[model samples]
Target: MRNPISGAISTLAARPLVRSALTVVTALSAVLFADALLSAPPAAAQQGFGNFFSYQAPKPRRTAKKKRQVDPAATQRAEPGKAGEAKKAEKSGPTQPVSIIVSLGDQHASIYDANGFVTRTRVSSGQAGHRTPSGVFSIIGKSRWHRSNIYSGAPMPYMQRITWSGVALHAGVVPGYPASHGCIRLPAGFAPQLFGMTRMGARVVVSPSDVQPVEFSHPLLPTPKMQEVQVPQETATQTAQQASVELASADVSPDKTAATETKLLNPIAFASVLKKRAVAEKAAASAAEKAALQAAQTAGAEARQATTDLDKAEANLKAAEAKAADPAPVPSAKVQPASQAPTDTGATPSPEEVAAQAEVAQAKAALEQARATKAEKSAAAFAAVEAYKLAAARAEEAGNLIDEAERRSEQVSVLISRKEGRIFIRQAWKPVWEAPITIRDPERPIGTHIYSAVEPSADGSKMRWTAITMPAAKASTSSSRDRKKSKTAEASQAAVAPPETASGALDRIELPDDARQRISELLWTGGSLIVTDEPRSPEMSENATDFIVLTR
Candidate 1:
C-alpha cells in the first residue's frame, strides 16, 4: 500500500526516455571527476545512474582485460598493472627532457624520463600505403584538439606533431592493428597521459624494434694518471749513479723546432694552395663556359646561313617550277623572212628545250640538298645550346664547391666513429689529433651523436655545445634484470642525481697526459663535433666534413 504520489514518481523513473536522459547527465558528471592521466577521484563521486546500464565488449583470450572504451557512461578504471606503475611514477616524480621510443615490431611505445624508464604501452601505426617512417624526431607542435586537414577533417584528439608533413601521434580508435593513414594511433586513455608528460622539443625515437640503454666501461672513463715507481737505494754506488751522469760525445739529437715551425706554417701554405685551386677551377669553368658559348654562336651563325640558303633554294625551286610550266619562246624563221617560205614556229621541243628541262631538274636537286643541310645545321645548333647549359651548370657547381671548401677549411670540425669510438679533430683542413672516448653504454646503441660547440670565448675553454643523439634502427632496449646487484642499488641514487649534459667540462674522459694537454690547446672558437655509427665518407674526407651519420 504505497502512496499514489510515490507510485507515480516510480512509474516516471521506469520510462526508457527518462532513464536515458538521466544516464547522459550521470555520465557527464563522472567525466568532471576524472581529468588527469595518473589520478582518480573517490568512488562516491562516481556513484550515479550511469552504472544501471553496463556495456561490455567481447574480450580476446590474450587480452582478457577490458579494452579502453570511449563510452561516456562507463566507469573509467585503470588497468590491473597500472596502479603499481602509477606508484612507481609517483616515486620518480616529473621527468625533464622526456624521450619516447616507439617500436614497430612490438607495436609498443615507451617513455623515458630524465632519470630512466617511466611507462610503456601499445600503439597502432600506419597501414598499407601509409607506413610510419622510422627515425629519431622531436615533437614540434601540439594540439589539444585537432582535426586532420588531409583526411576529411577527422578528429585527432591530443595530437602531437613530429613532422611538418602531417605525421603525428594522436588519440584514436586502435583496433589492435595497423590502420592509421601515417599518423600513430594511441589509446584514447593513454594519449591524454602522454600529452601531459611531453612538451615541444621532447625526443621521439621510432624504430623497427625496441632499444634500451646499458652500462659500459672503456679507456675513456675518467681515471687518475698512473704514478711513476721509485725504489729505495741502500748502496753508495747507486746514490753516486743517481747524482751524476757521464756526458757522451754522440748525445746530439736532431732539432725539431724548425720542423714544428714548418708544421705550423703548413696551414698558411695549404691556404694558398686552396686559393690557387679555386682560382684554377674558376678559370677552367669560365673557359668551358666561353667555349660552349662560342660553339653556340658558331652553330647559330651556321644555322642562320643554312636558313638563308634554304630561302634562296626555295626561290630557285619556285622559278624552276614556273619555267618548267611555261618555257620562253625561241626565235623562229617566220619572223626573219616571209620569203624563206613558211617556217614552223609551233613544233615538238628541240634539243635546247630538253636542256632547259635538265636545268630545272638540277635546280630541284640543289634545293633538296639545301633543305637537308638546313636540318643538319638546326640539329647542331640545338646540341650547342645544350652544351652551353651543361657548361653553365658545371661552372655553378664548381663555384659552389669552392666556396664550401674554403668555408670548411676555415671552420674547426671533428669526426667521431662508433666503430673506432674515437674522436678525430681537424682545424683548417689538417688533422690536429685524435683521442679515445667512451660512450656511457657502449654495448647498447649509441647512435649518431652530434655536439655543436656554440658561442665560444676567443679560446675554446669557456664554451658550450648542443647535443643530438639519434640511435640506429638495429639498436635494442636493455633489460633491468641484466644490471648487477650493486648497480640496482645505485639506481635510486642516480635517479635523484642531476644528469650528465653534453656541454661544459666532461669529467668522464680519462686521457693520457699528452692527449689531455693537446685538447686544451686547440679550442679556437665556432666549431662543431659530430659522432656517428657509420664510417666517414670518402667524398667528405676529401672535400669537406660531413655532419651527422646514423646509418648502419
Candidate 2:
C-alpha cells in the first residue's frame, strides 16, 4: 500500500510460490485418495451375504443298520399262512402226465406218464402240393369222425382230429414221410393206440426234426370198452333232458342259457340236421346276422384305407402321365434307319407289325427314361421336404424368440420415439454430421451414437450436426501415419503365415516300387501320366492308382 509498483511485484512473486504449494497439496491429496480407494475391501465382502443368512448345515449321512437275525422256528411260526399255501401248491402239482415228444419230421409221437413213456407209429404229412405249415399250433378242437378229401375220400380210420380246418393224425397208409395231400397220416392200425396215450388237453410238440429215441419200459394196460351198457331210448332222452336242465340252471340265467346253447348246437344241426331240428334255424339266422355286421364293418374300414391310398397313387400317376406326354426329339439318323428297315424287307410290312415294333422300341426307351426321371425327382422331392422341415423349425424358433422379446417389452415401462432428431443431430451452418443411435430403453442413459445427421429438434431435445469432415491439418497427418503403421503391421503378420496343405495332398506317399517305377517310365516315355485303378490309403499300388497327371 505504501509503494504500489513494489507491492504489485511482490504480490506477483508470491503468487507463483502459492500456486506451487497448492499444486503439491492437490497431488498429495489425490495420491492419498487413490491409495484409500485401492486398499479398501470389496463392497460384497460382508459375511453371510450370499445365501449365508438362511443357510442350513448339511445332514449327516445315514449308515445302513445290520438286520437282526431270527431263529428258523420263529420265522416259520411268523408266517403260518405261507405253510398252508406251500401245502396247497404241493397238492396241485402236475396231477396228469403231459406228452413228452412230438416229431413232425419223422412223423412219430410219444407220451409220458408218472410210471414211464409210450411211443407211437410213424405218420405221413401233407404232400408237396399242399405242404404242412410248420408252426407251433395248439389243439383247438377234436373230432372222432374226421374224413379226408384225398386218399379216395376214405373215412380216416381211428380219427382223432386235432386242427379244426381238417388236418389230423388218423389211421392211414404211411408211405415213409409226407405222402398224403395235407393230413398227418398215421401208420395202419396205430391211430387208436396213439389216441389212447393222449389226453383231451395234452400238449403236442411238432418240431422240425426228430429228437433222440426214448425207450418205454412200462406199457399201459388197455381198458375194456362197454359193449352192452345201453339204456332205453326214453331213459336216455330223459337223462339228456336232466343234464340240459342242470346246465341251464348253473351260472347262466334260463333265457341266456337257452340263447347260448341254441347258438352252439344250431350251427351243427342247421347244415346237417335241418329236418330234425326246425327250431335251430332261428339261432343260425342270428349268427348269420352277426357275421353280416362284422363283414360290413371290415369292408368299410378297407374301403376307407383304399380311398386314401388311391388318392395318393392317382396324384403320382398324373404327374408321370404328364411327363410321358411331352414329345422327345428324335435324331434324323434314327428316323432314316427306321424308314429304311421297312423298305429293305422284300414285302411291305403290315401296318400292325410296324406299329407293334415301333411301340415296343418306344416303350422300352420310355420306361428307362421314366425310371431315371423318377429317381431324380424323388431325390429332389426328398431334399425339398427336408429343406421345408428345416425352414419350418427355424421359423418356429424365431417366432418363439420374438414372442419372448415382446413379452419382455411389455414388462418395461419406457417411451420410444422414432423421429429422426430423436437419434441424430443436424446443424444449419455446418455440413451435416449424421449419427444414428438405438435406444434399447429410453429410460436409461443414451448409449453410443451409431451415425450422425445435420438436423436438430426445435426444442433442442435433439441436435442435427453437419456431416463430420476432418480438417486437413496436423491431426489428419497423424491419423494417416497411424493407419499406415497399422497396415504395415498387418502385412508383416500376414507375411509370417504358416504354409497350407492342399485339401487332399499327402507327403511321403507310400506306393509299391513297381507301380512307382512304371509311372516314372510312362512319364519319361512321353505317355500321359494316367493310372487307372482303385484308390487306397497308406500305400498306392499299380492296381490302386486312379488318375492322370499331364505335363508338357
Candidate 3:
C-alpha cells in the first residue's frame, strides 16, 4: 500500500487555493520591481530601453520577385485589369500626424496627415497696410462665431487665431488674390469642416520661403535632455448643447441675427492653472533679471570709485616717499631741542623731522587701506556680474518656457508620478481627470519615461506616440559592445518578461476601467505623457504650473 502521509502532502500542494495565493504573491513582487525604474540605468533609444524614442520603425516593404522578361502585350493580356484593381485596394496607416503649411507666394495652404498629403486649397492673404506676417505659428484660438474688436465689430465666422495680435485663418471672401486685413481667408464650407477636424495646438507654418519637413538624423534631436513644453487649458463658456445649436445655424454677415448666442469662455478659468503659473513665473524671471542688472551696475560704479581712491592714495604715498628719500637739511638734522639741558649729552629730534616720519607712516596706512578697498570692490563687481548672468539666464529660460506654454495651451498632456503611483490627464494646463495606476515592480530598477503623441487615426479615435525612457537618477553605463549585446539579449528576454515591465510607450501604462473609458473618448493628436520619479510639489497650489516643477 502507498504511504497515506505522502498522498496528503501532494493533494495539499495541488490545491487551487494554494496556486492562486502564489500568483498573487508573484504579482506583488512585480509591482515592487517596477518601482526600481527610478534607481536603474536605461539603455539607448534605438535598440532596447532608451531615455528617448521616435516613430516606430516602418514595416519593411515587400519586394516583388522578378520573372523572365515577357512581351508587354502578352503580360497585359494575361492580367487584363486585375493589376489596377489590386492597386485600388491597397491601404496604409490608420492615421497620421497633422501639420499645416501656408504659402503667400502660391496663395495656397496645405494640410498633411501622418502617411502623406491630405488637403490643398487656395487662400487669400493680407492687403498692403495690413500685411500678414510670415513665420511659423501654432493655432492658439478657434471660434465658430467670432467678431473682430480691432475692426469695426466685423463678424469672423469659423475663425482660427494664430497670433496674439489677431492674425487668423477664417472663412471669408477669397478674391483669388491677397485682399484681407492680415488674415488668411478660406473657402466657406471648408472652414467649418476643418475646424471640426482640427484639435488645439495644431502647427500652422506660414512661410514666405518654400519649405517642407524632411527626414534627417542628427545628434541634436534629443538624448541627454529632451522635452516639449505644452500649453495650458482653457474653459468653455457655452454648454455643449448650446455650441452645437449655434454652430448649426452659423452666420458671419453684419446683418446676421444678433439673437445667435456666441460663445466666449472666461480666459482666467479657461486657461489652466499651469498656464497662469507659467506667465507669473515669466514675469518673476523678468523682475529678477532687472534687479540683478541694477545690482551689477551699482557694484561696477563702486569698483571704479575704489580704483580712483587707490590712485590718489598711491600718489600721496609717492610724495611722502620722495620727501623721506631726500637728504634732510644738514642744519635741520644737526638742530637739537632748545629746552635740552647742557649736562644732557643726548640730542632730541626736531618737530619738523618727527612730523615727516609720521606723515610717511600715515601715507603708507592710507595706501594699504586703498589697496584693500579696491580688491573688495573688484570682487564685489565680479560677483555682481555673475549673479546678474545667472539671474538673466533664469529669466530667459522662464520667458522661453512661457512662450512655449502659451503656444501649446490647447494640447493634451499626461502626468505619471512614482511617488503617488498614479497617472493624471491634462489639457491646456487643466486637469481633465486622474486615476490610480500601478507599476509592474516597485523594488526593481525603473526609470522616468515620457511618451508623446505624434500620429492619430483617421477618425482621431486612437493615438500613437513616441517614447523616451531615461535611466534612474543614478545608473551606470556599459561598454558599447556590451550594450549592443544587451539589446539583442533583451529582445529575446522580453518575450518571457512580465507585463509589468514598461517599454515607455503609451501601452506601457495600465489604466483603471474608468481612466480607460476617458482615454477612448478624449484621444487626440500631439499629446504628451510625462512620467517622473518625483512627487507633485506641495507648492503647486492654485495658479501654479506643474511643468515648472517637473522641469526643475
For residues 1-552, what per-residue lDDT tens digits would candidate 3 score against the true structure? 554445545665666674677775665554434433323344222333322223334355699988964332221111244443322222231143455667665577766544434555567788656766654445667899999979988888999887656788998887666789889888774576456656555656665433344322222111111111122111122233343211111122112333333332221122333355666777888898899999999999999999999999999988887777663764534655778726657777666677777888999999999999999999999999999999899888877666654534345556677667887876554566887887555454344444445654332333445543332221225555664554221111111222222343233445566765544333344555556565654433332232312211
Instruction: Compute the lDDT of residue 224 as modeled in candidate 3.
Output: 14
**Candidate numbers sorted by lDDT from highest down:** 1, 3, 2
Each candidate's clash count? 5, 29, 35
**lDDT tens digits, residues 1-552, model 2?**
154434544655666564676775665555444444333444323221222223333345699988964322321121234444323322443223333244544455544333223333456666546644332222333456656655566888766544445656677777655666566766555565455555543334343343321221111101111111223344334435652211111122123223222221111111122221222333454455555555555555555555555555555555555545553433354454554665554776555555555655555565555555555555555555555555455545544444432222111101112232121111111111223333233242221111111122332122222111111111123354664554221111111111211111111112333433322211110011101111111221222121111100
Decide which is better by lDDT, 1 or 2: 1
- Model 3, global lDDT: 0.55
- Superposition error at 425 for model 3 (Å): 19
Task: Give me the runs in candidate 2 sitting further than 4 Å from their true place.
Answer: 1-95, 114-116, 149-152, 212-552
Give per-residue CA lDDT, model 1, range 1-552, as digits (tens).
444444554655666764677775665444433322113223322432222233223333485678855531121222355555544664554445466777665576777654456677667888657877765555767999999999999999999987667889999877665678888888887788788888664657665555543322223222211111121222223323431211111111113342211111112223333444566677898899999999999998999999999999889878877777777777666454568766678878866568778878988898899999999999999999999999998888878667644553343556656567777766554566777766545544334544443333332124444444443343323444542332221121111111333331133333456654443343322344544555654323332322323232
TM-score of 3: 0.32
Report clash pairs, candidate 1. Answer: 211-476, 211-477, 212-476, 212-477, 212-478
Local distance difference test, each candidate: 0.56, 0.36, 0.55
By summed lDDT, the worst window of 10 consecutive residues in model 3 runs over: 220-229
TM-score versus the correct structure, for each prediction:
0.32, 0.21, 0.32
